[model samples]
Target: MTVRTDLLIVGAGPTGLTLGIDLARRGVDALVVERADGLFPGSRGKGIQPRTMEVFDDLGVLDAIRAAGGSYPVGMIWQDGKRVGEHRMFDPAEVTEDSPHAEPWMVPQWRTQEILFGRLEELGGQVAFGREVVGLTQDEDGVTVRFPAGESVRARYVVAADGGRSAVRRAVGIGMTGETVDPSPMLVADVRIAGLDRDNWHIFPPHGEGDGFLAVCPLAGTEDFQVVARFPEGASVDVSLEGIRKVVAARSHLAPDDVTEVRWASGFRPRAALADRFRDGRVFLAGDAAHVHSPAGGQGLNTSVQDAYNLGWKLGAVLRDGAAAGLLDTYEEERRHVAADMLGLSTSVHRGEVRRGEATCQLGLGYRESSLTKETRATPGAVRAGDRAPDGNLDGVRLFDAFRGPHWTVVAVGVEAPVVPEAVRVVRGRALESYGCGVFLVRPDGYVGWAGDQTAGGLGYLGRFGGR
Candidate 1:
């Protein structure tokens, strides 16, 4: 049988689910297919950076995410079965009107996917489990994906969110350029344990020159702890229950039996890689398929989610809002640069050259150099075009509330509002300190697409993307 859709998203992990949610909310017909029968069952990629929290807020899942997770605890160092010292997980940042969510929130990867999946289903999105893309052929008009069961899916566009070892990426023949961030293989597991207090993240440093460090962090909102242990270079990691218990007993004061339940386990060597290209004809790579991080600095999942956020609106505009096809080209033009920067940041954090502070939070990320951005103001204010539209109050209305949904917004801050397309939402009021005195055209994804001192420049910029 042949199924058809405007967009076919491979892998129902955070990226595909997020793209599905965004497209569904825009009334765009998109399908998300995954090889696995269900969501990823692990606590990996648990750090939800403050910027991602804003993305979740726009997607309408922030409340659920905040409810399901808690703040990261202080790190408690252990040596010779005794407490040594304390370590802060992230650099402190104050919550401001513009940046409300200042720190990283901890929720297991599985729960985040579940919440996204739930939101997708609620928005009338569809996910076909067990549909693996074994082969793919793309024409000028659309791409046809083949499955092992002889089923075929034809889509105007296809996205690969399948992961670092992406089948669709291979089918498209995209090459990944990367380096091993660390030679030591690491083991990660989600386990239920006794004898450990949940107040702090437990850390056990390497005992000797040849030994490796181990860390056990309480997975918030669940009775489980995420254990990460490193092995000496060239040493194989053991992921079995007994293997984990042995490590825990040797590294910490807890006994082997203290690890009462081993929920899941996996092993990997820390590596950083990025696809040579984000797009290949009608097929585009996203998430781990596009760029694989070291899992340090908590950038992989957050960057992946933002990829979906970046591509979703462009897809919706082309398919639903009569946008020019050239608008889609900006996806690679914009995201490729961001991915390269994030890859560097992840590697830096893994090597301890960069701290997990303002940089890792991702609020500073933007597309100032993108072709889509129009900065007509000669002397720009603190907030400029291509910067993220910060959350704040304008005339007693929360800016985020006005920016919510699948529509563009015009924030006229102490300026005459331009005549925009009837579809665009406009808010006129005194200049917000975060926005400054200008006419800001906010994209549906919450970035300032165009900013100018007057209305003429802003109106023309919008006309190119159906904003007129």
Candidate 2:
């Protein structure tokens, strides 16, 4: 059986699902396929960063996610059974007042997906489970996709979100170039504790004969916590409850019997790798399909969500109104930098004794190299025209209305302001001092297109992105 659609997305994970929802909301029909029968129920990738929260807010799913999960204000780093340092997450609510997004929230990946999948359904899109894309062929006009169920789909564009071992990427002959970390098998378990400490994330650095470290983080709405033990090379210990109990007892004074119940457990290795290219003609890749890195910073899920968000609006614009195909190229140019930077940072976090900082994981990224960036001469750390525009209020208007589509937002401050046409949503406020003023153009995906003083070629900057 052969089907047709405007876009065919391979994989039904968070990235693919979010892409489908974004396209559907824009009235651009998309078909998503997944090999799994249903959502993966696991404790994988539980931290949702601020940028991701803003993306979710734009998609109108933030409220659902918040309702599903709560927040933790602090993340701690420990060494030798003592607290070394602590970093508090920038409050998403406070940050969003001046940002495109409010603040980052902590939630399980499954809960985040549940809300996103619900939103996709509300947008009249559905995932075709138990279907996998086995092969793909793309030309200038479109892509022809073959599935394992003896089915085929012809789409104007194809997205590979099938994960690190992506079949679509292989079929298209894209090389995923990078180094894999040595297989240091780590034991991960989710369990309930009767008398163990539960105040904050617990870290036990290598002590005595143990090889690596043990980390404990709280699981919201439950009395249990997620425990991660990085075993030293050649360390022999089973991942069973008795094994965990013995290890905990050996490292800390905690007893094995203190662990009342074990909810889940697994052992896996982490790696850092990225695709050499993100696009090949009509086919593109997103999420883990393009890059894979250590979970040390909890950035895998957040980065993947951002990847889909960036591609969603661009692809929707192209499919619906014939927006420039050049926009699609920016995905690779922009996200690959992010992935490379992530790989570097994760490598550091993995080896060094220092705990990763939230700023390194969240705030420091900027898409200045993109053609969409306007103010080129700005210094580093300065809010340039093309960076991720910070969130703040303009007059009384909020920057992003998650329930509705984002508009070309113009932030005009100062006594002498350029007259922006009615086609743009202009907000006049003094809060622009922290972010910027003159004129700021925001892409539909909530990225800054251009920002500069009113006299800094605001008109030219606006014209670049189709603002009249």
lDDT tens digits by residue: candidate 2, 1-468: 889999999988888998988888878879988888987666677777777777777788877877776666365666544578874433224433555433445676666777788899988999999887777787878899987767899999999999999999999999987775646778778877765455667766676664777777777645668888878776654778888887776665467787777777777777889898999998899999998978766778888888888888778656765557787888888888887887777666776644545554465577877866776334422466666666655676655541236346665555255676565666666745566445566677666677666546776766544452
Candidate 1, 1-468: lDDT as tens digits: 999999999999999999999999999989999999989999999999999999999999999999999999999999998998999989999999889999999999999999999999999998999988899999999999999999999999999999999999999899999999999999999999999899999999989888889999999999999999999899888889999999999888899999999999999999999899999998989999999999999999999999999999999999988889889999999998899899999999999999999999999999899999989988899999999999899998888899888889999999899887788999989868877898999999999999988888777777777662
Q: Best candidate, TM-score-wise?
A: 1
TM-score of 2: 0.86
TM-score against native, each model: 0.99, 0.86
- The per-model lDDT (C-alpha) reads 0.93, 0.73
For the record, the alpha-carbon RMSD of candidate 1 to the native fold, in angstroms, is 0.9
RMSD of each: 0.9, 3.9
Candidate 1: where are CA atoms >4 Å away?
Answer: none
Clashes of 1: 0
The alpha-carbon deviation from the true structure for residue 64 of candidate 1, after best TM-score superposition, in angstroms, is: 0.4
State model 2's lDDT.
0.73
Those runs of model 2 whose alpha carbons end farther than 4 Å from true positions after fitting are 73-104, 234-263, 376-382, 401-406, 415-424, 429-431, 452-468
* Top candidate when judged by lDDT against the true structure: 1
